[model samples]
Structures are given as C-alpha cells and as structure tokens.
Target chain A: MAREASVSEVLLDARGIAKSFGGVQALRDVSLTIGRGEIYGLIGPNGAGKTTFFNVLTGLYSADSGEVQFDGARLDIGLPHLVTRQGIARTFQNIRLFANMSALENVMVGRHLRSHASVIGAVLRNRATRREEADIVDRAHRLLRYVGVDARANDLARHLSYGDQRRLEIARALATEPKLLALDEPAAGMNATETASLRQLVESIRADGVTVLLIEHDVKLVMGLCDRVAVLDYGEKIAEDVPDRVQRDPKVVEAYLGGALA
Target chain B: MTTLEGKRRDPRVALAGTLLLAVALALAPFAVGAGAGIAWVRVIDFALLYIMLALGLNIVVGFAGLLDLGYIAFYAVGAYLYALLSSPHLAGAFPSLAPGLHWPIWAILPLGALVAGAFGVILGAPTLRLRGDYLAIVTLGFGEIIRIFMNNLNRPVNLTNGPQGITQIDPIGIGGVSFGRTLDVFGIGLPSVYLYYYLFLGATLLVVFVSIRLEDSRIGRAWVAIREDEIAAKACGINTRNIKLLAFAMGASFGGVAGGLFAGFQQFVSPESFTLMESVMVLCMVVLGGMGHIPGVIFGGILLTLLPEALRYGAGPVQTALFGKVLVPPESLRMLLFGLALILVMLYRPAGLWPSAIRRREFAGAGNSPENGAGSERE
Candidate 1:
C-alpha cells in the first residue's frame, strides 16, 4: 500500500487477451495493468486461467486476440526468448533449470542475452570475449550469493535442494536484468520457514526497482505482500483492486466458493 | 571437480604432457611397423580422420543434442566437391571443362567445408521443430537421399560419375612436399602413409583445438543448455533455432574438411564410402566414448576404429588356432564381436565409457534423492 500511493505509471498493460485450447476457453478478455515498482499478486483456484494468463504474457502461448504493451512498446506474443530479451523474465511453476549445468552456469545462461560473444569470438577466445566471459562468471556468482545459493554454485542444478533450486531459478531469472520479474508459484512446495524467506526475497527484489507479478496459491502471502491483487475465476477477472478491497468483494467470495448461486 | 582440472593444471605439466603426446604420435607408425605391416599405419591415418569426423559429429549429437544421423552427407558433399574440382572426371564429362579446375588443397579444403556447411544449414532449417527420435529419422532419410543422388547424378550430368565414383583425384601437397609420395626427413624415410599421418594429425589437432575452444565458450554453454532443456534454454533468452542451425553448420564443416582429406588420401572417392553404416559408425564412436567430453570422444573414436581392425586381424587366426580349422569367416566374426561389444557397453555403461562429469554425476546420483529429477532426463 505504501508503493501503491506512489504508483503513477504502468509497467505492463495487457488488454483483452483471450486463449482457447480445443473447445475449452482457457482465457477470455483477461486484462491486467501492473504498476512500476509494485508487487502485484494474481490469485485463483484450480483451472482459473491464472497459469494460462502467465503463459500468454511470457510468450509461451499465443493469445487468440490480445495486445501486450510493456515499457511503452507493443510486445510480440509468441516468441519466448524475445520476451526475455524485451526485459520480462519468468520462472515456471515446475522448476525448469538446466539440470546438467552447475548453478553458476545456469545463471550465466540467463545472462546470455545481455552478453555479446559471437562464434568467432568464442572459438578464438579474443580479449573482449574473455573479458565478457569473466564478467559473466563474476555476475553469476554475485547472483547466486544474492539468492543465498552461493554455496551450491558448483553443484549441478538437479543436485540442489528443492528450496535451493527454487532460489537458483530466481537467481537465473534475475540474471536477465528484467524490468518485470514474473514468478509462477514461487512458494509452491516450500515449508513455512522457506516461504517466509521467499517472501523477504520477493520484497528485496521489488526494492531493487524490478516490478514483480506474482501468481501464488498462498492467499495469506498474497494478501500480506501484494500492493494490489487480482482474482480470476472461469477465465475471467472477477476482482482487481487493492488487497483489502479485493478480499472483501462478494463476487470474489462467491467465485472462490464455486459460484453455486450464480 | 575433475572438469576444471584442464584449466587448473600447471603450465609445465601441461607442456610436458603435450610434448610426450607428440613424441608418441610421431613414432606411432614406426612402433606399429615393429609389430605389424605398414598398412596399419594407413589404418591409423584413417583413424585420425575418423577422430576428426567423430569430434565434428559430437557437436551436433553430443553438444547440441540434435541427433544428426545424416552427418555423413556433409562428408559426402565435401569428398564429392574435392573430387570434382581436383580430378579429370569433369573434363571427361564435359568438353568445355577440358583442362579441369584442379583447385589447390588450401582453396579446396575451405570450399569443401563451406559447401558442406551450407548443406548442413539446408538440412537444419526445416528440421528445427524436431527433436530426438524424429530428428534422427529425418537426418537418416536425408543421408540416404544424398547417397542415392550421388549414385545416380551421372545420368543427366556426370557430376558424381555415377556409382563408380571419381578416380585419380589429385593428392594434397604443399610447396614441393606431396603427401602422396614418401619423403626423406633427416634420412629417416617417412612413407606416404606416415606423411599423410602427420598431415591428418595436424588437421585433427586443429579440429580438436576448435572443439575444445567451443566446449568452454559462451556458444558452447548455449549448446549444452539447449541440449539439457530446450524450453529452459529459450527462457534464458537463447534463440534455439539459430543455435541449433549453428551447431549443424559447424559440425558439418568439420565433417566436410575430413571428407576432403579422405578424398586426397585415397585419391579416389565413391558413393560407397559415404554409406549409412559410416554415419552409424561415427555416431557409435561418440556414444561409446562419452557424448560431450572431448577426451572421452577422442578415446571413443580411436578405440572404435582400432578395435574393429584388431578384431579383423585376430578373429581368423583365433578361430583357426582354437578349432584347428576355420569356423567362421573373420569378416562376419569381427562384426559379431563388435555388435556384442556395443551391446555390452550400452547395458553396463549407458552413460558411455567416459561420460562428462555432469552426466556421470547424474547416473551416480540416480534414485538416491527423491528430488533427483533424473526421471525427466531419460535421453
């Protein structure tokens, strides 16, 4: 709410987005406006199109009809790498680290778009390429330390603890230096302690000036952390307001209760 | 970890190791001469060529995880290019080309590699959406298509000279030193095979160096990332399509250079040399050694090449000695033993004889932790 009072500009404006998969409408006219430097939470029950919207925003799935304008320019819908290049980095609900690479190497891979090393430069190991590679390693190490996974820098991603792996994924996403960091279920399987630390980490990331769009099932965390919250049910945005107001909305309550009387 | 050993080794130790390796390689033919016929030196030369081919293929199948079963098509493209440019076949087919091109070795090598790389890109473009088994099948079909084209291209235009292939191709030479003839270096007669061995050794070393450089570079990391998980790689801002195409082109160029060297070494090339079995053999070398590890891949190539030859020589003698009469022909017996060896390796060492440290850890840590995630890594 402190950040919401100062929120004057929108970082991401996705309008009239719709997606369907073989007779099932996954998302319908779903729109979202995330403010700069604010933690925005999207909460929904099972099959409420929360993930579908995330997928469409991050370019994993093409929207049937929509326009996403991020940081002023219109975003291309279905090219995932381009989406990352355009300053929006995302983490999957199921962690998708490069399992064979070291944690440090995984973060270095995320720094790929920021670095400029051509094939000739790589094969020759020119001075510029060497310097860039060194910078990449240094940055990756710092990111691991930031995510509290520096001790596991040399460990393969698959070998990391589940909570540590989640942290590493966040570190990798941060390596992209995104204007918007979209996390899909960052606290999905964490213990209470892990979730608490994750909440702090999210707060720190937002403090670093990167806008965060969180999709979480933990209602308490969303209410406590988000400056504003949006609720989706049956492919529609039922409520979008500050956490207190959205929490008290009768429509949101009915939607969460399966809308039996609707 | 052992992966960092090469970078962390003492300079003196590394230099000494290199010198020792050079001495052993320089004397390898003589060492073989002491035990067997000099023809084995030619076999070793071919083995070096195969090492180059295997390393190249490793980029596609091992590093990028593209599973290019049609890799030999690039080799064929290079060999045919060298043959057409360096041989009198072109003149025989067309009166306008009476003098023939007869391009120099330096010009032909790069040209062959470029043409072959272009072919690689051509093969890679449409197959970008494929992975694993489907990619393998498409590549297999592509390889056969090239072979069949070479076999019948003599009809309308005598480019490949039909199945008979181009003969009397020019041998590679440099400044009065021809690899086709023996040379007296310091009064120690270096036979043509030994000379070709040195040339092929230098070429293989260059290829090895390139492969090493590629494996540790940013591009190499992108390749390995794609191999590990394509979707994850894309999420990390890697353009998977371009990276995949680059792998194909780079891998094919190496194959092309090897093919050109092969033509120059044999002074003749036929469609028979570029068979599906040849591609399978090179792939076997990669998988048998260690898919992505350079030293492992080199070991795999040498072992596979020499093991079959060793079996060929020993099979007949052992059969006659054991039974007091010839039981099975050495040719068939050699293949049988080779197949048995491959099966045994796959059964016991599914990660290969010398897997990369990462893969080795994966196999070792399998089922040890509930969060191992090894189940998703069943490649």
Candidate 2:
C-alpha cells in the first residue's frame, strides 16, 4: 500500500512491541509509526488488542519486548505521568472527567504539568502564583471555547450533556499542550450531528499542530479523517497505508468480514 | 438567566452569612455570664481544635479521597514533639542536652508541625500505591504502632516516660501575654480561657482560609481529579505519587499544629489522648459536615464537638424533670441521645448537613447519564 503525502516526518515510532497477560498473548510483534501532524487511525475488530497497544504507548502497560520512541527519545513505559510529561496525552474510552469539579477546573488539571505553583504558593496565594492561576483560568476558558463547551464552563463536568462531556474531555487533554494526542472512541454513543461536530473538532485539534492518534470503531469516520491508517488483527499489524488502500487490503477485509465473506 | 442570576447572588449572601457567623462566634463568650463564659470558652477551644483536625483530614479523605484511619498518629507526633521540646521532664533524661532550655511556644509550634509533616511523608511514601480499605488498614496499623511505642518506649533511656505521659509541659505564650494566665485587655480582666479562645479562633480561621485557597487552586483540582480517577489523573500529567504524599503531609501538618495547641492548652501529653476513637471522631466530623467542602466540615466539627457536651448538661435536667429524681444517669442518657442524633443525621442527610455543591447534586441525582458511565467506572 502507498504512503500518504502527510506521512513524511515520523513523530512516534514503535518497533517490535509485544505484550502478554499470563497465558494470553495479548499482542505480538506489533509496530507502527505516526508522522508529525498526521491524523493516524488505529482500527481493528473487538479483542484485536487495540486498547492494549494504546495502554503500552501511554505507559499504562509495559511491552514485554519492544521499544517506543517519541520525539527522537526512548519513551519510558509503566510510568503514566512521566509519559504525559514527555508530551503525550490521552483520553479514555470511557469519559473520565473529574465529575465533581467544574468544567473549567477539569481543564486546569491538564495544566498541572505546565504550571509550577507549589503547595506553599497555593496556600499563600502570592502575586506570582495568582498571576499563574489567572493565566491558567484564562487558557482553560479558551480551551473550553475551542472545544465548544465554554458555555458550560462553570458547570460540573458530570452535569454536562454527553456531547459536551466529550468536548470537555478533549479540552482537558489539550490543556496539557501535548505534542501527541491519543483519543479512544471519541464518537462512541454519539448521534450523527454530534459525530459531525466531533469530526470538525478533531480536524481543528490537528490544525492546532498536535499529532492525532485515534482508535475508532467507526470505519467511515476513520477512513475520512485519518491521513494514514493501521489495521490490527489477532495482536499483529496486517496493513499500514493510506485509509483507502488499507480499506481495500485483502487481509483487512478477511479479518473484518471473515474469510468466507472475503 | 434565572440560574445565572441565582449564581451571581450566591457569593454575596454567603459572604454576609459568614460575616454574621464570625461576629456571633467572637461575641459568644460575652453572651453567657462570667461563670458560664469560662466553661463555654473551654468547650469552644476544644471544638476549634477538632475543627482544625477535621479540616486536615479533609485534605486526605475529602479532596484526595484517601482513606486515612491513622491520622491521629500525626497528632500524637505533634503533641509529643511540643512536649519534648518545651517540657522540663526531658531535662531529667538528657542532662547534657540542656532540655531545660525550653523553646518559645511560637517557635515550637512550627517545629511541631514540621516534625509531624516529616512523619507524614515517611508514612505516605511507602503506602502511596495502597487505596481504600487497604490504605485505611495500613494507616490504622500505623496509629497503633505510634500509640504502642508511646505506651512502652521507656526502654534503655526513658524517652517518652512510657504510660505515665509527660507533665509540667510549658504553656504557649508571647512575651508578657501568657495564654495560661489571665490577661488584662483594654482594662477588662480576661480569663485564661478567653485568651485561649481567641488564639484557637484565629488558628481555626487560618486553617479555614488555607483550606478554601487550596480548594480553589490548580493543585486542588488535580487532587479532585486524582480522587475521581487516578489513571486519568496520571494521563493528564499529574504525578499521583507526589500529590498523594502531599495530601498526607499537608493533612498531617494541620493535625500536628492542633496537637501542639492541644499540649499547650492541657499542659500535658498522654498516649490516652491520641486514640483510634479520636481519628474516627475527626473523620465523622468531615463526613457529617460534608467531605470536600470546608464550611460543611467546620459545621460538622462544631456540631459533633458541642452536641455530646450539650447533651450531658441537658440530661441532668431532662432526668430530674422526667422522674422527680435521677431515673437514668446523665452520662448514659447523654450517650444514648448523641448516638440517636448521629443516626438521625445520617438517615435524613446522608450527604451531610452542608454537603459540597457537587455532593448535593449527587444526592439529588441531577447528573446521572448512562452514557457518561457515572456508576460503573468510578474508582
């Protein structure tokens, strides 16, 4: 399959990544590269270890044997916060906003790594910390507005509607100012209208210069949005190419439609 | 627009209410006569101390959502630190150290808080990964360990004086204004209790202000995020390990400061004072007030502290009026009434007397969307 035009400069390189959970070989010899500013799609049927790969990339899990390089340095595995500090941010398959916190506060949490206000600073509310705090609030508001949830900025995150919640999650992720943004099932349970807006949101995120790695079950959305797509089946990469070619790949068709249908 | 108007009006009303409450608290001693004033001051002193403890525990259990059952251990550490640094009893054990040179109370207070905070870090470092009941059990064990050591640590050198505890502890004072003695303020001869009442009031207010600042800060949001979902919090670039330890240490520092104040007021330090019941009572204050909400915790602390004593005083009159003589003793009746009050509060207001806005919404069932995964995925 031919490479997409935007896939020239690699941003995230994973080579020979493998993982096993006790007796279950969850992933074996899986590898993929995401180019800078490219909308990369990772698509597979259920139980194809898509989430497992995401977990390994985000440092929630350690690959049994492999290496992941992000921004030209070896990415540390098994320390999720460190991975985030290294400029990789992610949203969960299930929305995990701080339910009790206001939407603005939820986004400010993403600025945790960026802001250096100490405990003493927080308690004292000194000039510098106050300035930093004001900046955080302003930036958080801007992020909310960008994600189309600024109207509910003061509302508790859990109180937001489903589409608003999804947008708020995206806003929180963006607040971290990551070099790479990984989103898992951003359009899950969304209506057609919501999905259309989400598409615009994803494009805007990429337009803001953040590399996007998306895991989605919506084939049409992936095919339309991703610059390059990787298809996984039985814990191994079957095809890696432009969306159209990956969709037409014989192995991908057999994996999804079954050998009889293919 | 109606909701916006209501939201805009809330802070003004809350501010005015807070001012009213502050004025009432300041004049409370004078509202009662001299004889009753002293007694009320003493009760208020203890209540303020409990409020400080509750606020500290709220950082760990409320904001960070870490269940710490051994929080009293830090209090004990602070109390004993103050006792050791300022008491003459230590002079007898370490003659060369010149323990007779008691540090000033103001100086020792911060020292006590620091020492207690250090111990908190020590306790938290190893237990950062533990959560819920497991974390609680470990903390419970830590509390028992501290108590057991204080009870039997007279070996080799007699450090803590074993179960007899430390006495002749120096009282807190500044220059000529000693809290242990009556002071003439503005031509009025104020009682020692009055001085302590004012001091405790100031300390309680400081703690409340700090708690409020913390609740509104970025770190506070990170703490709430950690509480909601640790994995998500980490993915958001929050160092969960350091934040959890910070919560423990910060909470312990408050406990420590209160313990120092406790030592100064009581002029004694004993293992019996720091018990599992004290930790549970402080926790009850946080829960009954409202977890993660500062004002709710304050209300909880005051109500729980005063209710038992109030019931004790009422029981005597209650018994005398009901049976012409003492039918049931005041102590037994007081306990029964206290238990009944707590049960009633829990049954009627499960979220708390004054729950945080979020908790109030939760209890009202305002934000439960099935697609949001509100129920199944909560940590």
- Which 10-residue window in model 1 chain B sums to the lowest lDDT? B370-379
Candidate 1 Cα lDDT to native = 0.89
Candidate 2 pairs with clashing backbones: none
After superposition, the stretches of candidate 1 with alpha carbons farther than 4 Å from their true spots are A1-6, A260-262, B1-7, B368-379
Worst 10 residues of 1 chain A by lDDT: A1-10
Candidate 1 — which pairs collide? none
**Which one wins on TM-score?**
1
The sequence of per-residue lDDT tens digits that candidate 1 reaches over residues B1-379 is 2333335779899999999989999889899877788978988998999999999999998888888888899999999999999988899779898777688899999999899989999999999988878899999999999999999999887888888999989888877788898899899888899889889999999999999888887788899888888877887889989999999999999999999999999999999999999999999999999888888899999999999999999888888889998788889888999999999998898778988777788778756431233224321
- Candidate 2 residue lDDT tens string, A1-262: 4544546688999999999999988899998999999999999999899999999999999899999999999999888989999988998888888876778888989999999888889889899998998899899989989999998987878789999998899899999999999999899999999999999999999998999999999999999999989999999999998888888899999999899732
Candidate 1, residue B356: the lDDT equals: 79
lDDT of 1 by residue, A65-182 (tens): 9899999999878998999999999998999888878898899989889998887898888999989989999999999999999998888888899999999999999999999999
Off by over 4 Å in 2: A1-6, A260-262, B1-23, B33-37, B98-101, B366-379
| Least accurate 10 contiguous residues by lDDT in model 2 chain B | B370-379
Q: Local error of candidate 1 at B9, Å?
A: 3.0
